[model samples]
Target: MTTLRTLTACFLTFLLSLAAAVAGKPNIILVMSDDQGWGDVAFREHPVLKTPHLDKMAAESLVLEQAYASAPVCSPSRASILTGRTPNRSTCYRHGHSMHPKEETLPQILKKYGYATGHFGKWHLGTLYKNSPVNPTAAGYDEWISAPNFFDIDPTLSNKGVATQYKGDSSEITMRLALDFIKRQSAAKQPFFTTVWYGSPHDPHKALDRDKVGYEKLGQHKANFLGEITELDRTVGELRAALRELGIEKETIVWFCSDNGGLKNLGVTGGRAHKGTVYEGGLRVPSIIEWPGKVKAGISKLPTNGSDMLPTVLELAGIEHQPKHPLDGVSIAKTVLGQEKAQPHPLGFWHYDVAGIGCWGEREMQALLKLQQAGQEVTDPKQLRSSGKPVKVSTKANSYPGHSAWLDYPWKLHRIESKKGKVSWELYNLALDPMESKNLTSEKKAEFEALKQAHLNWLQSVQTSMKGADYE
Candidate 1:
């Protein structure tokens, strides 16, 4: 004899339980290393550099052999990863340029779904100190201890706009703080979305003596360079171990990648030329998505990049997200699960003519420290960047400068526009010439023309985006 009131109460209880379950989504940790090459890992047959822990992770997870960074440069790649759109759309056209205020970031979405979001280490997307409207918090992180650019030993970072000088290796300190945040979230029974971007193996390589022991056979600079990567590897191992100890490794998603390609001098790039170029060497990076038993193990030839991160993670969490603006990336969740193959969309890369805004890490940090010590709030407009405008590009119609590439898998096309406004084209069959040495524009006129047209159409869309047409 069930009463009507009892049935209603039961339905209400079920709704509450379902809401709680949705709130406890899987934890996601995205770790990115700066300047690490596609061949830097031991599994790639590197002559000396060894990454035992990363190799093990790759063995357990799906490896994207053809992974690309959204752009050949750092800031654009970072911006694309956060917003799942072309970086230039957000006004992050070059390094040191800040993201636009209107873009919806991954952390912002995750936080809305009851996740504790955090960002650690390099925050080169914008100025971290003083209230730049584009800082980590502005990007929707609940906690962040980040630097202006690629920082090194004993770096002074902004802890949510407060100047705090930390002691120890850069990656180590970043990981330690990230772990602390993870532990707190876990203790509170909250899911976390943490991003740890390490500043390692970047210019002016500084490595501790202990880490540089075996690399002396290489020149001092190369030794220090390799040593920094070695230390970065150790930090990665610790992060995995900590997840295991928490009994959440199987449920957590640990996505690892580098922002861009290796330096030309390093000779570690997998393709021709090096960083800052539109060639495979500059875009291709070592990427892995580890979810213990969830992600299928083995190599995936799918052409993916940082832009795919937001959509992929959201799909993995079973959260349906439709971006407010056009997305340059699509969800690769099926690919991760081994249910699908082949990239669903083509990736676009562009390097606009604007010069990168330079950021001096230590100097800026010291300046912030001085302001803090003087009991003055960060009111400097330059530090705040409220008036700092993006490089105006929409004013000129059909004025595409710098290099742009369209990677449509087997066939690739390049559109190079010199500062003098002279435009040229290069075509390569990547499946045949991975080095992109021999041009096939004249040989395969049909394929080249098709890609060239597609790329031109894409440029028009990108230009529209730059005009803020996509923002709702």
Candidate 2:
């Protein structure tokens, strides 16, 4: 009887511990749109486009009025979000750059805590082919349905490792796959972390007929663009409804944002410049987080960036693991949960412009697809051909050129250097000049000089990390 009692007690304890773990972990869904602008949503009062579903999400979410992507482009910003470091720190200097395999990613960190991780949709960080060092699976995803870059109608996506085609609007197709994954995980009573990256509203402007008819007056291109956004908005609605249906609505965190700035001349630029530029319009994106039970629905203007996402996820999930390197992002858990109103550090952004490893283009993708179709053996050529090596940045450069900015709330500073060694400084009080129309460097000499030094110090730190100092 004594032995039986001891075994029974042990079994009960194990069950309770498992229950506690499941109760504490939240289902995290991060949904990002490619090239969707800050002003693209109806809630932002865009003159033409309407996004009813996203507007509803904004109304219920903890919206960030001044959220920025770590970089002005897609791949670098995605790398920043995954690694909690700025693009320069990882040498993900521009679009199409693959993250170094050595870097620890968010999915890898969460996996230690028993989260079933999955990635769906666009994966520009690297190739989606099987065994690619930078593929979603290699980066720590347990399951993934993704494309090498932005994929469109009848998209060819790699499901785990096999390339398959899907019908319907790209946004809807991506969300359906994510929802299926979420549903399966929920049914199995497992916590999940899913990334749904939509390729819509990026280029070539192909939208569903049902979504485009309402915007016919805007011209074919504009109509298609806006229609794609509407499709994306619909997917957001479906995701929220699915979570509610799964009885986990209050226990999930739904975060939404654009990968980068809007395309130029579509009149959706949120600030001074568009897309590849480092201006406010290029970097600032519409962002929101809906954590039903924890975060109160509200708005905040505290400066935040893509690098902050990983740290924030770790903090919220109660996971503790030190990275092998430094992180640029500060956790915003307190702010999101209505406990704090400001961030601990200033946001820094830079465009190094120097290319890293070249992208896995159409040719490689075709070869992989043919192999999959033939039911033959498939392996990632890029990962097999190259060594998983750390990047080394030079420490003795006289000066770093290109655009780098230090954003400390209303005080924004820009350091622009030309290849000819001509350097210029520009400053703006964002409170007064949201458009960055006037340069305040001449007027605020003291502020300009101080911020310049701050920017330089930050640049040096990033450069040190790039040289693999953090790994030591």
Best TM-score goes to which candidate? 1
lDDT (CA) for every model shown?
A: 0.87, 0.83
Which regions of candidate 2 fall more than 4 Å away from where they truly are? 1-22, 355-364, 375-385, 389-395
Give each model's clash number. Answer: 0, 0
Candidate 1 at 383: error in angstroms?
Answer: 2.1
TM-score computed on alpha carbons, candidate 2: 0.92
State the weakest 10-residue window (summed lDDT) of model 2. Answer: 384-393
Name the runs in model 1 displaced over 4 angstroms.
Answer: 1-18, 21-24
- What TM-score does candidate 1 get on C-alpha atoms? 0.95
Q: How many pairs of residues in model 1 come into backbone collision? A: 0
Expressed as tens digits, the lDDT of each residue in 240-273 for candidate 2 is 8999898999878999999888889884877998
lDDT of 1 by residue, 1-472 (tens): 4688899999999878756855747899999999888888888988888678888888888899999998888999899999998788787898888888788999999877778899999999878865788789989999999988998999999999899999999989989999999989888878889999998878779999988887899988998888898899899999999998989887799999999998888748869888888898998999999998788788988888888999999999988877788888888998888776665478888888888989888888888899889997777777688764666764367777889998888888899998888999998888899999888889999898889889988888888888877774
What is residue 229's positional error in candidate 2, in angstroms? 0.4
lDDT of 2 at 272: 96
